[model samples]
Target: MGKTTGFLEYDRIEESYLPVDKRLKNYKEFVIGINDSQAKIQGARCMDCGTPFCNNGCPVNNIIPDFNDLVYRQDWRAAIEVLHSTNNFPEFTGRICPAPCEAACTLGINDDPIGIKSIEHAIIDRAWEEGWVAPKPAEHKTGRKVAVVGAGPAGLAAAQQLARAGHDVTLFEKNDRVGGLLRYGIPDFKLEKSHIDRRVEQLKAEGVTIRTSVLVAGKDGLGKDSKVTNWANETVAPDALLADFDAVLLTGGSEQSRDLPVPGRELSGVHFAMEFLPQQNKVNAGDRLKGQIRADGKHVIVIGGGDTGSDCVGTSNRHGAQSVTQFELLPMPPEHENKPLVWPYWPIKLRTSSSHEEGCTREFAIATKEFIGEKGKLTGVKTVRLEWKDGKMSEVPGSEQILKADLVLLAMGFVSPVQSVLKAFGVDTDPRGNARASTDFSGGYATNVPKLFAAGDIRRGQSLVVWAIREGRQAARAVDEFLMGYSELPR
Candidate 1:
């Protein structure tokens, strides 16, 4: 424990950000990370409770207490080490993760939980500034090659781990740059691309080959002329991949956007959240997006109240939208959770993101029935109020309403992995349409196809980045075990 009574001594301190007015002008990271002294005080606040539930809380099972102790002592280097021991990229999660660990903190029952996430944020930012993070190449080569598809968090994590295990790892991405969802799906205002660029540099230094603009199985599914049409590499079929590489790991994300098939769905203004978000990211990266959907001088209605929806609200506001409204199918949850009942588990509660704070009209228990449009473009949305009974939701009659909107974004979340990618590999799939792979020690993450393994969103469906990292690390160990008779990679 950092301090005997640290929990009682210090209160939770929240991170600060630039004013919304100033920050909305451009897409840049606005959170001001804490300094070393502030971090120490925050670390000291960690009771490091015996039987630390924060470890269980975190998806990567980070050694929260040890890192807290290290930070409390101002051992910045050791703190980063401890943070990195479990999580491959604390910087990513430090900025974006919801921090279930805090909800699981034992101190949270009585007082505010320790600011473990902020502590990690401070530690990583400091480590990067001090040049402590570097690439560590393997001492000897295993002479085995592994191909990882997709360049998202899961793929990157698995690739990095395999590289450290002495295997030649080649990562393939259809996009122009690596960092799948992290690079494009996320808005630059939430996470900058520089973080991903630096990580790519380190991966290169560690001897990992990243082939951007490369497709693993076939031509760009987006067709001959895509928004990212510039990405064109030699096609490498999955069968050829199996013949060339010693093993193959599929870490593609769950990208099948759940669509609303209501009337007027063919309207020009309706787009998938993925379709809308990535264009802005590309523009922020200096790519021109001519005729891209803009909310400027328009009223926008974003369906779904999750992170993606919040992102749309933020982006639309930044685009100078005249008005923005968000609709949630489920009822609004309580502001606070019943701690005693849900202490060690993530709870259902109200979560107002930074985007919500920016500017938005939020509605709960509202469901969209149809998109009203004229001349094949969206004009408004027909919606109705819903009520829950016996855990089932149903719309209430006579509660219907019309919301004028110029553009609509479907942010209802993904259904599963792209079927074309999974079908290309001919891997077995679960009932939920995810790759079927066991996480047992004996089989590791191997799929029904021999020497083929799956991880991250491809295997587990849509999930948090931290969970993706955990799966990627474990999958690498499994692959290493399958490659050799034994393995030493950490779980």
Candidate 2:
């Protein structure tokens, strides 16, 4: 609304990236967001849509238009306030979230949408530079102790909110550091570790007790491939946590990666995306690893085409793999979406990430039939093309072929949280293996067990970081209400 004709006069200006040659040499964040002047112009492009679908599109329900107007008016301080009102970690989402808000932008119907994400990135970065980001310690103490089991987006958000609501929150992490997936799963190139470090300092300044390398449950409770990569110094039992804390919130993310059951999966050089990604993160953090999984000088094939797969592609390129190829079982999506049919909603369309643009061969409508290996090690993969008819896929006759590969990375996504953790806590789980909990406004997020609750990927399965933050904030409010019989914290 800052400029009624702004949309017509301006085209979307996206963030810039370093050239591939320079960026691939090191694992560091390379996205150069729009400057303040450019951000103001981008904000001016927000139209006065009677219904702001972008608000509903965002998982945290950010007041997009208000922030846009504020930025256009050059009120940078107020812009951050509006942003923080809904999103606890704009810096994280601004950097990593797939901006569904843009997809649901009304301006995107007939033209490019407002650069909302870039504006957010600019706003938060500016806020930090201007020293506006400070710890908000509670004025009063409620004397309630809460245990947040995971240090990912959800647990961090919940811990921050509960601490702000005058509760004594103790955040526990199995990893040596906070930030569950953000710390390890994501490559350093997309998100630098320094971002997480500053937030950890802020959390400590806010009176939240941060414990690292402490597993609430012993290692035996984890699934076979679900070993947390971080070094653990101690293990805390569930009974001790229940007895010590007034309430416990489970924010442990879905960690059980879906496995490829095809023959020869037990072969060497075959690993889960989690297994491969975390090692590189550890190495980036100055931890030298022996026998670390590397794609160097190997024909690397990454299964499952998604964010994790893209990450593998990027990392493999950085590792100087001989060749990199990605495979998607589903048919390739359309290059462009039918906007009229799917306006104001996330549409299914082909998304080519920066990793994809770097260098890799992508194969769609293909499935791995078997892992081809000799002498008990991976050598290649047998594959077959698929044909879809009547909403079902059938293997094409005589379509089987073996593709050369020396290393295979399974990025097929997670199935559920490790069942052992849920079993240890005795929390009920959904059929899909996620913690069972509701999102209703009344006493929601509470699990079947008394004083036990769940949030984020542990409750909702694998999802975007923005959604995890929303759930964490809401869960914190729920926990606060349970402890104090009422809460003023925003959901």
Candidate 3:
């Protein structure tokens, strides 16, 4: 710890965001960077407890205390070094990550947790500005070629790690650009595409070959920003990939959107959240749409109260939607969690997103009955209130009503990774439809196939970007061991 009584001396201070009125006008990053002095004060707030639960909270197992100490002492170069030792891309996480590490902080027991994420953001930005961040190519090549299917977080992190391990890595993405969901799924205001572009540049310098629009199995072209390269027609069969490379890794995202099956499901305006979110991102990137769905001058009903749903609210507001209402199937959670019961673990509370803070009418304990429309166009939604009893939900009698709606966004969540790709590779899937892969000590991240491996959403279903990076790093270590009979890369 930098200061013996640092935790006692300083209180946690979060980074500020641009005002809602000003930020809503354009899709650009709004969070302001913290100064060096502010970062040191925040780092000093880290208790650096004997056992850092923040590490456990972080999916990549980042050495939080060491980085905190480095930041407190104004050793930003060392801070980035410590951060890079575990996380491959702190800039990405620093911007969009939910920062579970702060939730699991020791100080959170009574007071606010240290601003670990903000300090992390400050450190990495300074490193980049001071000319400390650069590509570190492997000293020697292993002469082993690897084809990783997907350029999402998992695929990119795995490719970078393998490239650093001396393996020739060729990452394939069906999309026009890299950074899987980051490039298109997330809105530009929350995270700019330039962050991903810079990383792609750095990875190329490090010897990782990125083949975007090179869909591995005939997936749709990634509609994204103009700076990305498109190569979707190019594909590598799973078995062919296994034969060509010493080892193969599948890290595709969970793209199969969970649908809301109900009457009038075929209505023109009822669409999945993924279907709507990506289009706005494309438009922001200067793509013109012919039959694009818009919420402008219309009341919109968003089903599912998750991050994706929140995204819909933000996008709809920008489109000049007359009104936006978000619905959740479950009953409302308490405003705050029972800290003693949930401390050191992710809590289930009434968490709100920045989008929600902007403007949205949220409804809990509700279910959509049908999409009401005429002439095959959605006009309104019929819904019924619900109540929970004995761990099951039932619609309340006489609680049905119709809400005016020009668009219905299904943001419930993703069901699983696309099955066709796995089927083409003949990889077995779990009951939940994720690719079958074991996270065992002996052969971590290996699929049932001898030389094939699976990681990220392909293996673990829809999950956080941090988890994808962690698995990618671990899978790289595993592949290195399988090839050399030992490995120096950290798992």
Candidate 4:
């Protein structure tokens, strides 16, 4: 531990945010990170519990206590090293991850948890400013080539690791820019695109070739109304990729958004969250969008209260929406968890995001019955109150109402990866429609198809970016071992 009584001596400090009025006027990041002194104080709060549940709580399994100690001692150089040892991109997680690590912090058992995420954020941002993050290209070539589909976190991490392992790696993305969901799905107010651009530069310097706007699949792979957003200008046949690469790894994320099929679903003002979110991101990236699905001056009703719904609320607020409300199907969780019972694990509790703080009316235990509109234009939403009994939900008698709305966004979670991609690769799928692959260290990440592997949401279903990075790095090790009978890469 940095201090013998650090946990008792210091309280947890949180990162600050810009005023709501100021941040709502723009589409830029607003969360202000802590300074060196604040970070040190937060690091000192680490108790260095014997079990170190924070490490396991983090999807990338970052060594929490060591970095906390390093930061506490002001050894920032070593701090970044320890931080990067496990997480390929701490900046990404530090910005958006809910920080399960904090929930599992031993200190959090009875008090506020150490601010591990903020410490990591400060460390990475400092490393970037100091030019400490440099690409380390391979010393020798393995004379083998690998194709990594989807230029998101998983694909990028795997490509970088494979390049460092001396394998020629090519990463493909259907979007015009890399960073899949990170590039398009997530709003700029959460994470700007420049972060992704910088990582792309490093990946290139490490001898990885990145190709954007290229779709890899056979004909009849994607269906009409599939809702898998694509900005591809070129399509490469699966056979062509198979013939060109020595091995293949699929990391394409789950893009099929879970949709609401209700009466008046085809109304003009009704749209998927993906359709609305990506347009704003594209506009922020300097793309000219005609007739954009905007929320300006509209009564926006966002369905399915989750992160995506929160994002829509933020984006809508930025667009000067007249009013915004969110609906959730499940009953509200407790404001605070029963820590004794859920320590060292993510708990079900109320999570009010920064967006919710800006402005939003959140209604839990409500279900949308239909999109009410006139002449094919959405005007309102018909909703009914729900009650949960014995773990089952039923409608409350005569508790139906119509909510005024000019626009409705379906923010429900994703269902599965686009089936065409899996069909093109002919990979087996688990019952949940994810790629079938075990994570057993001995033969992990490999699909039933020889020389083909899968990782990230495509293999594990919709998940956090940190988890995607872990799978990518581990899958790279698996690939290296398969190629040269050994690998020096860390898991």
Per-model lDDT: 0.88, 0.93, 0.86, 0.91
Of candidates 4 and 1, the better by lDDT: 4
lDDT (10s digit) by residue, model 3, range 151-245: 88888888898899898989888877788888778889888888888889889999998877666652333322112333366665566677788
Candidate 2 lDDT over residue span 1-491, tens digit each: 66888888888999999999999999999899999889989988999888999999999999999999999999999999999999989999999999999999999999999999999999999999999999999999999999999999999999999999999999999889889999989899998989889988898999999999988875474646464455777888888898999999999999888999999999998999999999999999999899999998999999999999999999999999999999999999999999999988889999999998889999999999999889999999999999988889999999999999999999999999988889888889999999999998898999998899999999999999999999999999999999999999997
- Please give the lDDT score for candidate 3: 0.86
Clash count, predicted structure 4? 0
Highest lDDT among the candidates is held by which one? 2
Provide the RMSD of all predictions against the true structure, rounded to 1 decimal: 2.0, 1.1, 3.2, 0.9
Error of 3 at 454 (Å): 0.4
Per-residue error for 53 in candidate 1, Å, reads 0.7
Candidates' TM-scores? 0.97, 0.98, 0.96, 0.99
Per the 3 Å backbone cut-off, how many clashing residue pairs does candidate 3 have?
Answer: 4
Over the full model, what C-alpha lDDT does candidate 4 score relative to the true structure? 0.91
In model 4, which runs have C-alpha deviations exceeding 4 angstroms? none
Relative to the unseen true structure, what is the C-alpha lDDT of residue 442 in candidate 2, on a scale of 0 to 100? 91
Q: Rank the candidates by TM-score, best first.
A: 4, 2, 1, 3
